[model samples]
Target: MKKVRGIYIKNSAEIALMREANRIVSVVLDALGEAVAPGVPTMRFEEIAQDMCRQFGVQPAFQGYGGFPYALCCSVNEEVVHGFPSRERILREGDVVSFDMGVVYERFYGDSARTFAVGTVSDAARDLLDATRESLHRGIAQAQPGNNLYDVSRAVQEFVEARGYSVVRRFVGHGIGRKLHEKPEVPNFVPSGMAGPVLKPGMVLAIEPMVCAGTCEVEILEDKWTAVTKDRKLSAHFEHTVAVTHEGPVVLSVS
Candidate 1:
């Protein structure tokens, strides 16, 4: 593991607490996946997740973080991520919903996201979800200690691009813990000649892959929060808060 300044590396004890926080997120996500179906309003997701967080004695991490109004980002179809949840925004058959949420437990943060199929989705939609989730795993595999930061970026970019899909360049995964956004940002596409910091044993990151079925280009909607695709094609996102260890990369946000 690299000894780097300015980055917080959790010790085994602190990692245990982080795992507790991540477990809460994991269970909450599972419940959300089951509730994700046709005819369910997007705001319902925010309600359920918030209730679950309270039951677990945790706080919604995104509720007021940067003034985000809801407990979750309930983006649908062409919406890549950070879509505002609304009761008017209802889900229907063949629609794919991306549920992104996080929790604050004992002052530690846990984050994770997943895309779900509401009903019988098209072949193209299925492929997008499959590729995006797979890219997340591919990116996580590179989160091992001693690996450079961009290794995870290359893994995601190559996997998605090779499938003829585009990786959203505007948004990348990030380091998460104690505070929501941490230092040493993790990008999905690592540009030429830019190698990021080395992965250390105590380093914990929220590795996510924001993928698009069309161009990787994206635009911020007038809402000033929602991020959507420029080409208006479907997009999918998957994320996990992972930690680096001497043994390997350990996913913190999984129950």
Candidate 2:
């Protein structure tokens, strides 16, 4: 039976498969975490992700999807999500880069991202990363059955703003399953008078928090995919695929 909610709800069996898919994500992230540092080209990380996907027996969900050429979306410093990877974009000491990716295992998809420090970053950058990462956890904690969808959003905004950061409103967390992106349009901030739909068990959501150190305003680059802070200040992003349950929310992606 279909629920009134506009997103697909996974069953226990499907959730297990999704967990497996996200497990590959976790392993790849753990492997790549050690490789993030000064002098490494952004394209090199993309190569690492592609090889890992092949080794793990899964296909990359982003490569060739909507013309995205690489397995990983590498955004450095001021760039937010969907930054194109390139050999020219070399990491420097004190730079932070956000790597985003998705994988398909047994016909199910899992998507996640993390912002990593290149080497020795400034306190401002470190604090931005901390706040963005924590905002993701705060949002995921609200992904419980019977809670309104934007309850998760509200938590993200409150936690981020309280930490003196701004949450990105254009891009948001989303539902992921058979396809990379599913329905219900999970926003990271609670809009005015919006209660949103109620969460239920078996729902899988990719709760990502994109936080900016300055104004929340963002502008797309001429490339049309890279989103950067309009003020050119620092930004950070973190994400996880979570499954809502009677007990609470189960984070499918972990490292």
lDDT of 2 by residue, 140-236 (tens): 8899999999999999999999989998888988888888988777888998966688999988999999999998999999888899999999999
lDDT of 1 by residue, 1-255 (tens): 123656787888878888999899999999999998899999898999989988999999999888898889989999999998899999999999998989898888999999999999999999999999999999999998999999999999999999999988888788877888887788999878775898989999999999999998999999899998999999999999998999999998887
- What TM-score does candidate 1 get on C-alpha atoms? 0.97
Where model 1 places Cα greater than 4 Å from the true spot, the runs are 1-3
Clashing residue pairs in candidate 2 (N, C-alpha, C atoms within 3 angstroms): none
Question: lDDT of each structure?
Answer: 0.90, 0.90
- TM-score to true structure, per model: 0.97, 0.97
Point out where model 2 deviates above 4 Å. Answer: 1-3
